[model samples]
Target: DAGVTQSPTHLIKTRGQQVTLRCSPISGHKSVSWYQQVLGQGPQFIFQYYEKEERGRGNFPDRFSARQFPNYSSELNVNALLLGDSALYLCASSPTAVYGYTFGSGTRLTVV
Candidate 1:
């Protein structure tokens, strides 16, 4: 049973570019969530998916979007990247919508 896995452990992008982050949840996990952790701040919830549907969304802008697959894997898309968007994007998963969420190491995105 692997925990949530995020891809491109690190990324470098320029302003106005777009980026896509990937995540694969643990086996048998139906729920996946995304968070953004800025330096010196907590991880901010970005999106939550259950059964391939968007269940909850954070206060991010419209440029942020995500989708879950039949296998419970998910992808986070960020359009029109900005320097402020640089952060460690994390993926979390759990058996249910409750506690027990296991998080990934995160994808550190740096914008220049």
Candidate 2:
């Protein structure tokens, strides 16, 4: 089976701009999670969607948002981007909410 895939593997934006990142989960996985990994740090959980409904959210600000499609794919959007938002955004997929998460390579966003 194919692993999770993310689009626009890299991006550059200025502060105050907005950006959207896309993700496609492995076939048959029903849960998707979004995470942000800053340099030299572990990925921080952002959002989780199950069955197309939001199941979990992290300590991120309102500038962050996400949605899951019926096909199990997902997208992460950030508004009013800031330099702090620059990081590698990851997409993870799992069959359920508990374990077995498979992650994508990530979309690297560089906020200048």
Candidate 3:
């Protein structure tokens, strides 16, 4: 089976713009997807979508939103982007909520 995959490995955007990031979970996996990782910090939990519904969300502002498709793929959208939003947005998938996750390389977003 293929690993979790994220599109647009790198992206650039200006402040106040909106951007969308996409992810495809591994086959047969019910993804509990999760976060963003800064250069020197551990990943931050953003949201978890299981069975096509949001299960959890972190302390992020309302500008961040995400959804899972029927096919288990997911998309993260950020509106009114800020420079602070620039980071490596990671996509993680696991068979169960507590199981180990397989992570994608991430979409490196740079806000100019």
Candidate 4:
């Protein structure tokens, strides 16, 4: 009955480096989604995984990737990080087979 959980609540990275964020969905949830939120902007959908397969992705570059584990947990990875990549990386879960989500507090990422 727990809500979605994200790891490493905060992170600091340098430009050109890489970063990975983790998430664990709520119990009984089979769908997970990732989103990015800049300080003053709305959350942007990044990826959605349902039944361990990717079902949706946003406008992010190829450097952004993700995978869902057999346990339904998920990871989000970004390569060649850029200053603009600094933001809150959020994880959401839904019982919906398709879209609509409820997000976690997120792992705040800072790129210098």
Candidate 5:
């Protein structure tokens, strides 16, 4: 069973530019969540979607948004990216009815 996977292990962007990160969940899973991890900090939840419907969201600004597809894959979109937005974007997923979560290595975004 393949675990969660994220693309563009590293990225470089300028302030005000937009970026899109991708994720694919494990087989048979139905929930995908996006989190942002700044340097020296834990992952901050951005959004959670189950069965293509948003189940929860964190305190992130509107610039941070995400969506899950029918195949259980997901994409996180950040608009007007700032230097503070430069961080590790993590993708986590779990079974539709499970508790523990599995996280991807993440896309490291560096906004200059």
Candidate 6:
């Protein structure tokens, strides 16, 4: 079975531009969560969606948003990107809340 996967692996953006990052969850999984990890820091939760419904969200700005599709894939959209927005965006999935999460390598966003 394929694990969670993210696209691009790396990204470059300018201030005020928008970027969309994609993620594919593991097979048979229904829960997908987004997290942002700054350099030298742990991944911080951004959003969580289960059954295509918003389950949880972290303390991030409105510029950061995401949605999970019917196919269990997800996309994170960030608008008005700032230099501070530059970070590794990780996607994690789990069979259920009781299970541990498996994370993707991440899309490294560099906002200049």
On lDDT, the leading prediction is: 2
Kindly report which residue stretches of model 6 are placed more than 4 angstroms away from their true locations once superposed.
none
lDDT of 5 by residue, 72-109 (tens): 89999999999999999999999863476899999999
Model 3 ranges off by over 4 Å: none
Q: Indicate the residue-level lDDT of 44 in model 4.
A: 94
Q: Which pairs of residues collide in model 1? A: none
> Candidate 3 has what TM-score?
0.97
Report the error of model 4 at residue 112, Å. 0.7
Ranking by lDDT: 2, 1, 6, 4, 3, 5
Q: Which 10-residue span in candidate 5 carries the lowest summed lDDT?
A: 92-101
Rank the models by TM-score, top first: 2, 1, 6, 3, 5, 4
What TM-score goes with each of the models? Answer: 0.97, 0.98, 0.97, 0.95, 0.96, 0.97
Backbone clashes in model 4: 0
**Which numbered prediction scores highest in TM-score against the true structure?**
2
Winner on TM-score (1 vs 3): 1
Clashing pairs in 3: none
lDDT of each candidate versus the true structure: 0.95, 0.97, 0.91, 0.92, 0.91, 0.93
TM-score of 6: 0.97
- Write down the lDDT that model 5 would get: 0.91
Model 1: per-residue lDDT, tens digit, 8-111? 89999999999999999999999999999999999999999988889899999999999999999999999999999999999999888767899999999999
lDDT of 3: 0.91
lDDT, residue 100, model 2: 96
- Tell me which of candidates 2 and 4 scores higher on TM-score: 2
C-alpha RMSD in Å of predicted model 6 compared with the true structure: 0.8
